[model samples]
Target: MTTLPDHYEIVRERNGYGSADGAVGPVPAAERRRFVAVDDEGVFDRADRRRTLVATGVGMTGPPHLGTVGQFLTAVALQEAGLDVQFVLADLEPYHGGAPLDRVRRLAERYRTFALDLGFDPDRGRLRTQEGAREVMHTAQLLAPYYDPDRWTEDAGDDSGDTDPPPTEWERAVREAYEAGEDDRRSGTAAVARPGPSSEAADIHSAVLHGADFLHPLYAGDYERLVLQFGVDEHHLVGMARRFRDAAAVEGGVAGLYTRMIPGFDGTPKMAKSIPGAGVSLATSADEIRERIAGDPGGDPARSPVFQAMCLASRYDAERLGRLERACEAGDETWDRARSEYAEFVVGLAERWRATEE
Candidate 1:
């Protein structure tokens, strides 16, 4: 069995929250959230013994994108801090609704290779696909019923009619299959739900709300099961997990995943995937990275996607980062060079950081 670090207690206490009761009032949000903190000041004193950490998210299909890069950088920092980190590729999620099976598989392979090339240790960590995980489908099924629009009504005075309508008998059957632990049924249900994009924000909202409500409760049960199987204490992790699970349930879907929505390059409320020049992908070639920075609609590379990518990448030198910002503002001759320099710098820094542990 893996022994947890002494610092796990402190980190857990700092990040803990209470579990949710599905029918009751909503769960309260906690002040401090769980995260692996690492900087020049060094890793948290208690983090020395943390052997494994997991970073799981949906794979990129539109373009290999910078969001994936951000996640990998996060994993890299954890590994540099001496903790084992696993990158779980949630390919099943995209396969369910966003991307075709072949596209999803292709992206997963590319992402795995990118991660390996960038420094993730193949021995200590892996890029796993959720397609093989029966639990994900099972969980997806159990949560499907809560997504019924009839289960919730929109708040009075709210103009956005984003809440899902009542579930059809078909939807209920899908949920039943999931609840009964029918993996094949759950997968089939997910496969059927996978096509087409919703026309409005409200439609998207409704779908997310249902998914969150269903998944949160199901996750809580899974958490308890894991605690028992691993013989780990449920005190610290349970509360936060429950809070997120409940909030996701209440809000209805993955939309609640972002407690605070980040602004896009143009200072818009929503980031546009259609604007390729406005975003950066993890698989973005060096030339593409530079071109995007130069074409930023904001004209200020400091607040551009390039800068945002650097911040998320967390590999650029702090002093250099500031200089890059100032150079952009001043319209200095080195501004163009700064973009290339920063990208190369981050790539090298990530490589070095990943290599130290091995």
Candidate 2:
């Protein structure tokens, strides 16, 4: 496995993002580096902090996991750095994958309460569901013409110059369907609604909604810029939005900050909600969470989900985490000790928030 730093460097180069070496107020370069990459540091440096909105979200198909919690905390970090933040609960995005609206809404409510427990202040910013946001829905419709189905299909073909192929329309449809099925499995429901018949239309529709998800604040809230934070795999979504922003000649620009992913315990590339038992979640019992974290014999800190959780999700400072990493790499007992502590941290968080009546 690639070391964490080396992995992020490769991703930054591949996506044409600048080196993650800048500070947001007292946030510092080392702290920003935790996110891995950004579309342009200059965009961030130039923006008026009060007028810029830092946006991030997760699909409302399930409970919060380590990866998603990390994202929410990252948003809070930016808010602490003196910028406005918007944490979207993408209730509508998963409807394309066949997630029932009622079930999705319930998950969104739970997620909202959980985010508050994790320290997101609505007084400083916003946390909203896409389905309830009529302005965003209207903006999505306005931007619908900017998406081109033919171009995306061509880009996914064999003749394309890109080494990494974009997901074909059918592949995206299948992915959504699978995610919807995961929702069903997690909720213990046998049957549920699915997307519309045309896979191509569903794919394009999703792209449009995504574009609006990024731009609606700029359009409706009158924010001057958007700094989108997402996992590296979703870089294409940022690219698509950038293209739309340019084609439509929108007033403000959209910049990106990409973060590293934790490999799933089940051996998938990233810890994903669509896969059962892939990573630790706040909804499970304390002993069960510890068993899941400790039972896995993670060989190296770079490859360990526990260490990645500490880096991404926990409030561990950069210095402490760096020391732990170096010590673990030198083949000491640091990793064993650190992993036990991380397990307890996660268990405590779960007990505190998941037990809430809300």
> What are the root-mean-square deviations of the candidates from the true structure over C-alphas?
14.9, 5.0
Screening candidate 2 with a backbone cut-off below 3 angstroms (N, C-alpha, C), the clashing residue pairs are none
TM-score of 2: 0.82
Q: Which runs of model 1 end up more than 4 angstroms from their true locations?
A: 1-54, 135-277, 281-289, 296-302, 343-358
Candidate 2 regions with alpha-carbon error over 4 angstroms:
1-6, 23-26, 150-204, 296-299, 356-358
Indicate the residue-level lDDT of 19 in model 2: 64
Model 1 C-alpha lDDT per residue in residues 1-358, reported as the tens digit of each score: 1112222333223333121112111111111111222111121222323421333343444544454555565455545545444466656545555467788777677666667666677566445666654554555455545443332322211112234334334234324443433343355532222233334443444344333322432454321111100001212222223333564453211111111111234332212233322345434455655555565433454235555555555455546666766766666567667666666654554344334334
Residue 51 of model 2, lDDT score: 75
Best by lDDT: 2
Question: Residue 137's C-alpha lDDT in candidate 1?
Answer: 50
Instruction: Tell me the TM-score of each prediction against the true structure.
Output: 0.50, 0.82
Count of backbone clashes, every candidate in sequence? 16, 0
State the lDDT of candidate 2 residue by residue for 1-358, as single tens digits.
Answer: 3345565665566567776666344455445646767776766667466777788888755667788878878877777777788888877767766667677777778888888888898999889888787888889898777766543432333222255544544235436546755678667873333344236566677667777888887767578888888876565666666666776666776887778777667444456666555678777888989888776555676666777777788777788888767756664577667778888988987876665544
| C-alpha-based local distance difference test score of model 1 | 0.40
